[model samples]
Target: MEEKQIKTPHEVIASGGNVIKTRDDHSLILVGSDGTVLNSNECSWISDDKDNAVDNKLFRSRIEPWLTSLFQSEHLSLLCGSGITNAISSLAGAGTGTTMGETTFTNYKNEIVSAAQESAQASGREKGNIEDQIRVANDLLRGLKIIKDQNAAQLEKELNSIISNFAKSILNSENGIATAEENKRENAYRVLVNFLLSFASRTGNKERLSIFTTNYDRLLETGAELAGIHLMDRFVGNMMPIFRSSRLNLDIHYNPPGIRGEPRYLEGVARLTKLHGSIDWIQNGGEIRRIGLPFGAKAITPYLEAPGLDNANTMKLMIYPNSAKDRETAEYPYVELFRDFAASICRPNSTLVTYGYGFADEHINRVIHDMLTIPSTHLVIISYNDPIGRVLSFYSESAHKDQMSILMGGNLGDITNLANDYLPKSAIDRATIRMAELLQHRMGATSGLDKQATARQVSIVADVSTSEE
Candidate 1:
């Protein structure tokens, strides 16, 4: 038997190219050197036989130490990958990725981690004091920010260095492993999608579904798309381009150069709201633009850099690290969306299922607290590190004592328990096991109902019988 070839990161990068594309099923497919297609089938090995488990012990054995090292190291902070922002935010001190503190901490941590890793590599086994390294990293990060604020063009070179350093550290770490077979990326993606679907389905009473994430990657969108759901991001605009066209017709139908419509929503899915911008989004002049998935569709052309911070007008929409108050302004569509989403989900009888998201952001924390205050609302938080019930215990307040439930295991079975314990048993039957499932089921049903009603001749039908009667 011939031994299969294994490619190293150096070899992959040196080869000069790789393509990270989503498969038809919404799972990621990485095309590396020599046309190697790394898909879910190849990557699912990390979980052993427990394919549906979120926190596979074997998987964690590889992930935990890598993550712990990254966090503990003084040199690395911002870990950017496809849909990684929210996950990073959850692990950072900020808890919630959407909050100002969480966002800032993510950037800060990235910078620090970058510097520390560089120093460690250079020192070569002479372990430095973690605190000292953190201080140094923080100083460097602050200095980079100061340079940016001063609008020093030369400072960009230094900023690039900091960013590059952080990237290198992550790439060197185990978490940086991108290959399907090595990283178990497929399992993680599956778990995430399943959780979202189930949560959305379980909360049938929710009129609208809102998701706020800091991840720049397309995993969530891809997952939603595969599951036949529509996603909306304030920065990205509406997923349903039809709505954009309708709005444009009201303003520019008679204009000389015909106005191009924005992205539209999916027919049946709930709305997707991205708090941070997406990787595919671009900014030009002052207008934000996005790439079209359709083959013949013209790429969106913006007047400004798609989401550049250098442009004063464009900066508002960009997800830069800052304080909570800074994020509440209307100019920052993402921030506004976050606030609105919080209000919507915090209503009475609402249920929020937070999976990988840790309560790190104070802004999001406040929102959660508000939700907990509602008498009818329920909170279900799933974490591998802590039991679900105990996880909610961390947010202890006089009012929220009995309001939240925690599912404290690492498997999908825990999710089943979490849903059953917090939600009425009757609700579980209608509940989904993944985010995509809920979006598909709800959107499909709603669309069908709308069509059926519109097809009927009678405008109004009186109910002749009632259960009470």
Candidate 2:
């Protein structure tokens, strides 16, 4: 009998298994039917081996037919997950070890150890003091009580401070956002934003642009503003935008005085909905309000304050991890926000393109599945790893497979690049013009790119132009 050859991680996943990365960035382990490690690569998460790249390319080519179907749909919505945010930071040379996904227990553990060591040395305490602090952080990470001789309250405060600082680092005005990154070429956030803007601008005036995000970070908002695209979020007014669910349904229009003048659309290319509440959002008198702060602020504390209280509202309004997330969504603004998300997905002729969002949120997963029942609704899920649960089930089902496309082990650049290429001529043209305008801004030129240059770039790359050279 002939012996079988060892299969790569991608091959294992393609043959119906999962490729999960271990915490230590050690290996790409393949999980089997019974949830056991069937195989693993003693290498990086993104392998540089020729065989892996070839397999990825081949798999992508095989999925082109499905991609075509998704692109041809009338409406498009995008879901940005933590994975894509990490990709943005990595590509932008702005990795502060502080994106949403990097704020895990493991990362926090290391941070705690370093801080404890420094504090002990500065206080001239014995070496064992550092070790004692280390033990506290480890116990907290493992969901256990602090060891004897350590103050529980102190340890808890330290833990919270570490986590809060990590989140704040990722949200810092200077280096936090993905849009602040210099290079637009490899920046996934820029590419995704451009794709969203293109679809929203070129689509029919009545057709709504739906963008829903589970992340609390401002990557999408930052990118949208830099690109001169307006997001129609529930919050209105510059100082403090009050959150009203009804406002999401409103649209901005401009009507000229002349009888023959057609009403022109002014703002709101997309309905930017953050299902999970943001750091800037605060609860005031049973309602949510967006607090605007000056750039380069130190922390979340000094900015948000309850009425007539000396202390700041220290409650960070973010839906942190799983299980607890369900409970959090039941709260004030989240309930209203999620309701809009579900409604948007259910709309006829709507298509949602999800990036990096693992179908982990059960509430969101259920609504996505329910939306599929609508005949014209479509879903395109693109993630760095194989999708789990209902996402996998729906992708494998032959009945609705045509209406859905699941591209695993793919980057945001890949999905956006292919979709932009496959979009209709009108969308591609509009996107090219918009991209050219952005490029001109980057060059510090006062005037916009001429139609001749815009048309040339639109036909070629959709984003790149001769002026960029």
Specify the highest-lDDT model's number. 2
- Give the per-residue lDDT of model 1 (tens digit) for 1-469: 0111334322322343221211121222222333333333644333435432222333333232222222111111111122233342232222322211111123345655555545544433233234224334445645767767553343344444433333223222222222234334444444444544532332222144556564444556655655555544443244412112111111111222453553222223445545555434444445555544321112212322334424523222233321223333234444555565575566655656455444433455567777777786655444433212223334444366455543332232133322223222212222211333455478765366554433321111111111012
Q: Please name the candidate that would achieve the greatest TM-score relative to the true structure.
A: 2
Error of 2 at 25 (Å): 34
Q: So what's the TM-score on candidate 1?
A: 0.45
lDDT of each: 0.37, 0.54
Clashing residue pairs in candidate 2 (N, C-alpha, C atoms within 3 angstroms):
none
Write the residue-wise lDDT of candidate 2 on 1-469 in tens digits: 0111325555555444444332233334444333334443543433444433323343333343344334435566777766555655555555532433222234456665565555444333323232234334644544534244345555556656654565476466324443454564346565655645554553334356677887666767766776677788888677777788675367666775773566666643677888866667766656667877443355767676635323335334443422123554576777887788887778787888787776655567768878888888877666655433334544544355556655444332344544444233444444656777787788765354364454334333422233223
Candidate 1: which stretches are off by over 4 Å?
1-151, 161-179, 182-192, 202-206, 235-268, 292-319, 323-331, 386-393, 411-469
**Prediction 2 global C-alpha lDDT:** 0.54
Taking every candidate in turn, the Cα RMSD to the unseen true structure, in Å, is: 17.6, 13.3
Model 1 is weakest, by summed lDDT over 10 consecutive residues, at 459-468
Per-model TM-score, in order, reads 0.45, 0.61
